[model samples]
Target: MKEFLCTDKDFKDIAALVYNACGIVLGEHKREMVYSRLARRVREHRLKNFSEYLAYLNSNKDKEFDAFINAITTNLTSFFREPHHFEFLKHTIVPQLLNSNKVAKRVRVWSAGCSTGEEPYSLAITLADLFPSSWDVKILATDLDSNVLAKAQAGIYTAANVNGLEDKTLKKWFLKSKDGHTYKIKPKLNKNIFFKRLNLLQDWPMQGQFDLILCRNVVIYFDKETKDTLFKRYANALNNSGYLFLGHSESMGKEHSEFKNLGKTMYQKQHNARTV
Candidate 1:
C-alpha cells in the first residue's frame, strides 16, 4: 500500500460534509486523523490519492457515504469508562426515582452515542443490580456510526474490551467462548437494550419520554450552537423528573434553564424539583 496523502482541499470537503450531516466540528488539526482513518477507503477503492477518493465520494450517494462517515467519526468508548456516573445512578438517582410516588414505575434510559454497546450494557447491569426484575426497564443505545451500532447490537467483545471488568460481573453477564478471547453478552442483559443508528442532528423517531438520557462525551466535538440546540432537544425528550448526564468536559451552558446541575456532570429537570 502506497502512502496516501490527504490534501487541504480533501480535508475541507469532508469537514464540510460531516458538519452539515451530523454537526461534528472538525478543524485544521484533525487533517491527519481524517487522512489516516479514510486511507483504508482509498485503498479499498484503489483510488490514486485522497483527491480521487473525495471525487468518488462526491459522485456516489449510497452506502459509501455511510462508510465515509463511519471511517472518520471517532468512536472511542469502553465499559464503565466514567465509573462515577454509574455510581451516581446506583446510589442516588435510582433510589430517588424508586422512592418517588409521582413518577411512573416504568423506566426508560437513552444511552445517546453509545459505542459498541458498553455504556448500555453497563446500564443494564446497574439496573439489574438495583431494580427488581419485575420493573419495566428498557435502554435505547444509539450511535451515528452504523458499524458501531451493528457491533453494539451483537453484544460481543474481545478480552481487551472487558479488561477492567470484575470477575463476578463478567461471569454473571457474559458467556466466554471456547477460544477464551471472545465474550458474548448473555440474553438476559441483551434483552433490555435496543441498539439503533441515530444521527443527533436529524429527526429522532422515538416517541416515548425517557427517565434518563446519557449523552456524555458526545457533544464535545460539536460547535457551541449545535451543542445548545441538541441539549435543548434532550431536555424536551426527558420525563419531567428525568436526568441528563454529560461528559466530564461538557456542560449544558448557561442557555438551558430546564436542567439544574446536581454536580458530577449530572442534571435533573428543574420542573421536577420540589420548591421550598
Candidate 2:
C-alpha cells in the first residue's frame, strides 16, 4: 500500500506545477516517483493526505514551493562521470583555444545543470592542468537545485565519491580528511569555478558569452519545444565556434543548424549560422 493517497488529479497537478516551474516533464512513469518523494513533505507538514498537502502547498507557495521543487527534482552526479568529454576538452578543445584565443588569453566555460559540483570540478581540474595561471579562465557552474549548489560549493565528498580517479589526481587535487573518509577539493581547482542557482527556462543573467558550454544530461527531462528553445538560447549564449557538449544519449536534430555535430554528442557552433 502507498504511504500517501496520490490520485490521478493530484499527480496531474504535480506534473503541471513542475513543468510550469522548471520546464521538466513529469511523465506517467514518474507518478510513483513523485508520490514517494512528495510523501515525505506530506508527512512533514502533518498533512492527512496528498490532497491536503497540495492544498497547503497552494496556500503557502513562498515557503513550501522550494521544498516541493527540491524534492521532485533528481540530482545524480559524480566527478568525471563521463571521461571522454574531459579527454576531448584536454586534447582537442584546449588546443584549439590556445590557437584561437591566443591574443585574448581568455576562456570561459559553462557547466549547465552542474549537479553537486563534479562536472565543474572536473572541468576546473582539466583547465587548471593545462592553462597558464596567467591566462584568464573561468567556469560558471549553475543548477536549479539550491541544495546541490550548497553541497557543490562545499567541495567535500566521501572517499567513495572519488573511487575511480587516479591516485595522482587524488594526491594532486584533494586533501584527505583526518578520518580518511572524506576528501576536500584543493583551492587551486575550486578557484576557477563559480557555482550559481539557475533555472534554464528563465532569463539568464550572465553577460559575456562562453567559449564552451556543457549542458550534458540535462535536456532529456524537457519537452521538445523547451529543448529547442534552450538549444537556441545556448547558441546565442556561446561565442562563435564555441563548443557544446550534451549527454551521450542526447542529440540535436538537423533543425538546429547553428551547431555542427562533431560526433560523441559534441557540437561546434557554425560561424555563419542564422540565429533563432
Candidate 3:
C-alpha cells in the first residue's frame, strides 16, 4: 500500500487540475505516476492524505502550484539527442538563410519545451560553428518548469549527462571542472541563448518571428485539439519558409496546411498559408 491514500476521486481531481493548468492529459495509466510524484508534495506539507494536499494546493495556489507543475514535468534531454535535425540545420537551413537573409544577417531560433537546456544549447553550438561573428544570431529557449529552467540556465552537467558528446566538440564548447566530475558550457557558446519560463497554452510575448522552432516530443502528452492549436500557433510564430522540428514520434496532420512536411519530422512554413 501507498503511504498516502490516493483514491480514484483524488487521482481524477489531480488529473483535472493538471490538465486545466497546463494542457497535459493525465490518462488512467498515469494515476500511479501522478500519485508517486505528488505524494512527495503531500509529505512536504505534512498532509495526512492526497485529499488534504489538493485542498492546500487550491488554497495556496500562488505558492504551491509551481511546485506541483515542476514535480510532474518530464525533462529528459541531452546534447544532440537528435543528430539528424542538427545535420539538416547545418546543411540545408544554413545555406537557405545565407541567401535569403543577406541584408539582415539575423537568425532567430526557438526551442520550445527546451528541457534542461540541451536542445537550445545544441542549437547554439551549431549556430556558433557556422555563422560569422558579425551576424546577429540568437536562440530563445523556454519551458514551463522553473526548476529545470534554473538548471539549464546554470549550464552545468555531470559526466553522464554528456556521455556521448565527441571529444573535439566537448573540448571546444565546455570547460571541465577541476575535479573532472562535471562540465560547464563555455561563455562563448552560451552567450547567444536566452532562457525564459513560458507556458505554451498561454500568450507568447515575442514580437519578432523565428527562423526555426524546435518543439520536439512536447505535444505527445497533449490531446489532438491542443496539438492542432499549438501547430497553428507555431505556424504563426514562424517566418515565411521558417522551419519547425518535431520529435520522431510527432507529426502534423493534413489539416495543418500552413506547414509543408519535409520528412524526418521536419516541416517548413508554407509561403501562402493563412496564419491564426
- Ranking, TM-score, top scorer first: 3, 2, 1
Query: Which has the greatest TM-score?
Result: 3
* Candidate 3 ranges beyond 4 A from true positions: none
Q: How does model 2 fare in lDDT?
A: 0.93
> How do the residues 1-276 of candidate 2 rate in per-residue lDDT, one tens digit apiece?
877788899899999999999999999999888988999999999998899999999999999998899898889988887789899999999999999999999999999999899999999888896887779999999999889999999999998899999999999999999999999999978887999999999999999999999999999999999999999999999999999999988989999999999999999999966886
Q: How do all models score by TM-score?
A: 0.94, 0.98, 0.99
lDDT of each: 0.88, 0.93, 0.93
Deviation in angstroms for 211 in model 3?
A: 0.6
* Clashes, model 2: 0
Q: Which runs of model 2 end up more than 4 angstroms from their true locations?
A: none
* Model 3 per-residue lDDT tens digits across residues 62-131: 9999999999988898899889999999999999998999899999999999999989989988888788
User: RMSD in Å for candidate 2, one decimal?
Assistant: 0.9
lDDT of 3: 0.93
lDDT per residue for candidate 1 within 181-228, as digits (tens), equals: 999999989888888899999999999988899998999999998988
